[model samples]
Target: MLLPGSGSDDRFVRSAFAGPLSAFGITAVTPVPRPGAAVVDGYRAALDAAAAEPGPLVVGGVSLGAHVATAWAVRHCAALGSRLRGVFVALPAWTGPAGAAPAAQAARATAQLVREAGVAGALAQAAAGSPPWLADELGRAWPRYGPGLAPALDAAAVEPAPTADELAGLDVPVGIVALADDPVHPLAVARRWCAALPRAELVISSLAAFGADPELAGRASLLAWLKAGGR
Candidate 1:
């Protein structure tokens, strides 16, 4: 499934994944948030909806959605058992323990930005200064869907970030694609997630590469890994 990056809905994936991933015979499934649906519930339901489609089942998403996809699959995989294929997670947001001065500052700034400007202003500001292809991706995505993102942000941010201990329970095979420069989706957090989860592998990479070449960058590797598991 095409689990999208944060605040992005399926449209974000459409721009990023339509051409590159489909070549692998992968049908990315990006689900819209149901009205009044709890953010987490919507993601959980997205996984269910994707799994129900005729074909093989695998779960994946970008950033917060990526985190949600893996967390949900980790919890449910044993029941589905081996039918659960590997996960392809791109820039999974780091909700883990944070003592970094820079990260702490960025987190506060992000929270305040969203609070003051709503999702649009916050995302627009982030895009303007953001280097590489991600700026283009977020710029296109935020304006079209930013107003509706308040609920999703509220749902993910309301709680204290997910603890590493909590993630340890997720043992299903997972392939994590981590970016180097993203303040929110840091390499440190990706390493932590990989270490915490039992059956997980991580590939360190730059944020620019992920956005610029969806086919050649770590994303391609992620898809290859997921497919190799049992496709």
Candidate 2:
């Protein structure tokens, strides 16, 4: 199962992963969080839903979803046992605690802006400052989320990544994809994760590549998994 980033839903997740996973003959399942659900809570619920399905599961996500997936793996690995196949983490937004990451800080700022200006107004402000492609992407996504987007961002902004201890304890094969040119999803964060996790591999790509083709997110993660000797 794959999870979407903050403010994104099942549609975006499917768009990002279905093509690449299909190449491997794997079906992708994405869960959409209810509006107004807190980030950690919503994602945990999604994880639970995925875990309930029969067979071993490869869990993956982008940005906030990636962070949450790692945390869930740490918490549930014992109970899940071999049913947890692997984890594919794309664009890990932060290491350590939540407030330290620039992406979290930016999300907080964006949430505040959304609270004051509303989603449309905030999107306009963001579009003015963002590259055309990012602007277009957000323009398409944010409205669909409506008032829920800001709160979700705020929730993610405060949510923490898996601790170093958690990373060390993880036994599953792990794949990470980092966008080299994206400040919010720093390469250093990705490297830190690779260094900390026992069975992890990292791959670097550009944000533009991700923007142009979301399926590359899946491809990068899959490549990292193959590098780690996962079947």
Candidate 3:
């Protein structure tokens, strides 16, 4: 199962992961986000539902989605045993508490902007300095959140990702993808996660490359997982 980042929907997840997963004959299950503060719980519920299915499961996503997947994997690894295949984490934003993290601060600021200026206004402000591809992505996604956008962004901003300790407890192989040039999702955070995980590999790509082809991150992540003995 794959989930989207803060303010993003399953459409972006599908665009990022579907083609790459399909190349390996793996189906990507992208779930729609539940509105408001329930967003994280909703994603966990989706992971729970997917875990009930028969086949080996690989759960992952980008940014906030990556945090949720890692937390779920840590929480359920022993219960699920080998049925839990591995994790593919792309652009992990922070470790442990969300306190003062750049991504968290950005999300909070965005949420405030959304509340004060509305989605269209917030989007315009965000797009002014964003890369063209990122602006396009925000243009497509931010509006989809509608009235729930601010609350969801706030919830994600404050939500805690798996800590270094939590990550260390996960025995399954992990594939991590990071963009060296992306400041919001720092490469240092990704490196910390890779170091903490018992079995893991890291792949570095440029945000420009990812902007040109969404699947680049996914492909790199899967390759990292393979290198870490995921299959």
Among all windows of ten consecutive residues in candidate 3, which has the lowest summed lDDT? 140-149
lDDT of 1 by residue, 42-149 (tens): 778778877666656767777666667776776677777767777777766665533442434454566567778976678778878877566766666555544455
Descending-TM-score candidate ranking: 3, 2, 1
Compose the digit string of candidate 2's lDDT tens values, residues 21-94.
Answer: 88887888887755554656877887898788788788889988888888889889899998887899999987
* Whole-structure CA lDDT of model 2: 0.84
TM-score of 1: 0.76
Best by TM-score: 3
**C-alpha RMSD for every candidate:** 3.7, 1.4, 0.8
Q: How much lDDT does each candidate structure score? A: 0.63, 0.84, 0.93
Model 3 Cα shift for residue 128 (angstroms): 1.4
The candidate with the higher lDDT, 1 or 2, is 2
Q: What TM-score do all the candidates reach, one by one?
A: 0.76, 0.95, 0.98
lDDT tens digits by residue: candidate 3, 1-231: 998999988988888889988999889899998878889999999999999989799999999999999999999999999999999999999999999999999999999999999999999999998889889989998887899899999999998999999999999989999999999999999999999999999999998899999788789989999999988
Candidate 1 weakest lDDT stretch, 10 residues: 96-105
